[model samples]
Target chain A: MASYTERQAGSRLADYLSERAQVLSIALFFAICILFFSATTTTFLTTGNLLNVVRQAAPILIVAVAMTLVITTAGIDLSVGSLVALINALAAILMAAGLPWPVVVVLMLVAGGLIGGVQGWFISYQGIPAFIVTLAGLSILRGFALLLTEGYSIPIRDAAGFFWLGRGEVLGFPVPALLAILVAILGFIVMLHTQYGRQVVAVGSNMEAARRVGMPAKRVLASVYVVSGVASAIAGMLIAARLGSGSSNAAQGFELQVIAAVVLGGTSLMGGRASMTGTVLGTMTIAVIGNGLILMHISPFFTQIVTGTIILVAIWMNTRLFDRNWRFARRKPS
Target chain B: MMAAEAQATRGRGDAPLPPEPILRLRNIHKSFGSHEALRGVDLDIRPGECLGLIGDNAAGKSTLSKVISGTYIPDVGEIELNGRAVRFSTPSEARDLNIEMVYQDLSLCDHVDVVGNLFLGRELKRGPFLDQKRMLAQAETMLAALEIRIPRLTAKVEKLSGGQRQAIAIARAASFEPKILLMDEPTSALAVAEVEAVLGLINRVKARGVAVVLVTHRMQDLFRVCDRVAVMYEGTKVAERAIGETDLQELVDLIVGKGGH
Candidate 1:
């Protein structure tokens, strides 16, 4: 209670600007990417090609939104990539076994929530570090995925309509893009308008104060992980549907990319304070960068280099501006 | 002497009227390892009355409050809440029975607004949501009822002055509609005028018909707001007298045990 640290006035406004600045930067980056690629490539900005970019981004965007929420608790979920892979494997196995589409969809979502519950419970209830819980989860889920498929890939012939989730259009926009928008809106409502959402930030912002007031701290912490897990599974289903295949090797190293998008979008990984809008911008930023790289005929290897550089600079600028507003520079004794 | 003072306060109104004795403790003894924190202490609190507890450092005023509020279970003694015996293992247990304790730090959450902090541990929820608007309205009403001057309900506590923060803390506890409130040094770190502002709030608290155990090391605050002065010496209540019958020197002598006999 009393020990809960208060941010100085104007510091909140500084935070708002820094977050909004992420949106501005992302917009600028997207514009830059479009200008550069459209100038060089014959059809870099075509509607169909742009739709492909959104399709490619849809799943990663979902995963990034969840990562943003997890990181806002000052925790990370390294296993999200593996969770995605596992869901892919499960989708194939369930659908191949003649399960109904709805049944498989429900099963995938539950599996994701359950995985989150396990890791989140260990982190929040058992007092383990999220880094450790998710790190171990990453390895364990990967192992489970490999074991389920015996290290092989399974292709689904009947997942045709499901493919529309990853590529289908509604009056010309990708379904996944629309879905991402919906998720962002819902995340905003949950984080800003509900008591449970407020508690998430409260617990993330200060744990001891929450406890003294008798907040159900563990439950709040555990719920975010569940949300993250569900997001990962949804992402996995979308990815698998797009490929018409399930494989343990799918989404390898994707956790890093999702985390990069979340952080680059302006969500703090150290917990307390997240922006679903920022995450969406970050997801789109990554998508544009990836698409722009291909249009430039740059080696795919350059995609990471470009994203890492832009995000690093943006983050530094963000922190610097934040420090500036606080007049807040920590001056070491000369 | 304690018994006589306690009995005399039971008379009709305006005889220094000590209000109405709502809480009575008799010979409560507690010890931790080799140190006795409360040694056969006796005290009484009246409804709508402020009882200033004064003594030197380690005089056990805080320990006495904790024992009274059930933060710590007393090893020996009985506590009566409105003439009924009660033993509390947790603060909530006591709170549920209409007892609240306000700590010195004020224990207010800085990240949350005034209303959220007012209903901090005990929030009012509607269905699956925290009723922020209702809670804020109630907090505003509570402050208005006490006639406290807070500019806005959305103000983060960190933005408030020391006196305002204390007001919020007290408002929260009092709004819980507690029959008894134990405040632990509510104004220790405040500036002079801030202290006066707090004293005003204490008077407001008394006017609300809530019994209070006003613990402090400042005799000035004791003389100002306390209905009676209870002097604790080395964990024992050496003397407790009507404020009019007590002086600063006598209070000091009791706190230090009259030194060397």
Candidate 2:
């Protein structure tokens, strides 16, 4: 009879820590930011200021949820900012042309899906790199927005129902903030519980294996972009409703902000891993840093430089310090 | 062991058995552009037995296994499963028929946990949820049945040792109640002790009456678990022998293209 040696078992607690290390570090970083901001500025911890921060960050948070899905598939959509600008301008133009507000919303959503579908088809079916295709889309869509509006802002007037989506209140909470929270919660549930979420992770983790196991790999890959597009459209509409105007310049460089939030939330750019809770915290952290610096009497322009620097340092820490495999003390006996 | 083999043979019938294979391939041909990978190959796998498929590098062993597993569509051939001709258009089709292949690379997802990878494509879900609690309990049972003792089912596949990962992959295939299991180079990277565990696992699977096709460069492994050996050279099967009728030297000579002394 052949006898086999049993593998020595390691502690489960260490394994849990290693797996959640990135999320934990980000959470700690977020808590530290909150504490620092509260100490530096008296107004930072106030409910009014916090609500305002959530209201303003709502658009980025909405799109960041979708971008989390995109990045998890090892793909990027550089065209998101441009898509937002286009939808923003188009929503105003259509509403000004006497189109009903609800109809315009539907039209904008469909437009987003169509644009995303076209880009997705090229990337997934035509085998063009997502970076290259979306990079081209960034230029083309922005150009279309600029040409359509001729680089002008259009005012949206007398649509109180439309305005409520962005600026209205519900139980003292900003409606946009509430919507963003809902989106994040929905994203978290889908990533954790749904079959579609599993498929997305599986496709990201191992495309060949997913395909071999009979997943609709290409379709799933393309659909993530469509989700992104629809998300951008919603964010674009929200921005227009809040400002009561649409401009070709709306959401310029917004894609970078969304990507920053998602990556900061601990979603890997290398694909196959994601964290919705991390993303929610990351969005708030950035929003707080931006808002807090202004409250501290720092130059608003200077806040941009600080935000950029913080992103670089934080991501550096995330990849180098947290992700590496290193034991913290000996494994505790179970 | 000999008495067990006799019981298996007698269970089928006292009548002369023609050894109807669970999986049969005849005149299988495959080509990669200008390169001929498999040339006029014929192979058979009987129930309750191990077929050791050994050959030199590029001898079409991998390609032949792929054909049976539906990873490759043969240019011209006949594949009979359970004495009936069947053609598989995709790997999933073969999987549906309980033909499982453990690829040389293992094909387990690194980001997923052991439980998740075990039920990778076919997950157990309840009302759109993963039913993780159920899966966890079942995964414990699955590993226990295989005598594979991984301390944590929640541990990611990447966190595991190579042997443990290999064991999980085999356990996954075996749990599916596969009629035919094809493993390619499963123990090639394992340590001496790990190899023994895998060989032990093979015997356990074999005792369940599943037809197994093991393709390996490890000749010594053949004598350990294989009931029969098939030798291949340059895309053609050169020799087939029952384990009792041949020795390692003769099989090695046949693989190296030598006439026996």
User: Which candidate leads in DockQ?
Assistant: 2
Compute the lDDT of residue A82 as modeled in candidate 2.
99
Give a tens-digit lDDT track for model 1, residues B146-246. Answer: 66667667755665788788878777777777888888888776667667766776767777887778888777777677677787888988777776666
- Fnat values, one per model, are 0.31, 0.54
DockQ of each: 0.31, 0.58
Find the candidate with the highest TM-score and give its number.
Answer: 2
Q: What is the lDDT of residue B92 in candidate 1?
A: 60
What are the iRMS values of all candidates?
3.4, 1.4
Which sections of candidate 1 miss by over 4 Å? A1-44, A306-321, A324-334, B1-46, B53-96, B119-139, B144-167, B189-193, B228-245, B250-261
Top-lDDT structure, candidate number:
2
Model 2 ranges off by over 4 Å:
A1-12, A323-334, B1-16, B83-85, B191-197, B259-261
lDDT of candidate 1 over A173-202, digit per residue (tens)? 888888877887777777766777667766
Q: Across residues A1-334, which tens digit of lDDT does each residue of candidate 2 receive? A: 9998867776677777777776787789889988999999999999999999999999999999999998888899999999999999999999999999999999999999999999999988898999999999999999999999999999998899999998999999999999899999999999988778888888888887777676778999999999999999999999999999999999877887888788888887778888888888888888888898899999988766766776687667656655433223344499
TM-score of each: 0.80, 0.91
- Can you write out model 2's per-residue Cα lDDT over B1-261, one digit (the tens) per residue? 454355345544532464678888999999999999999999989987889999889999999998998889999999999989999988889999999988887888777789988887888999978888898999999888767778789877877888898888877877888889899998877778668877877887887888899999887788778878898899989899876567778888988889342
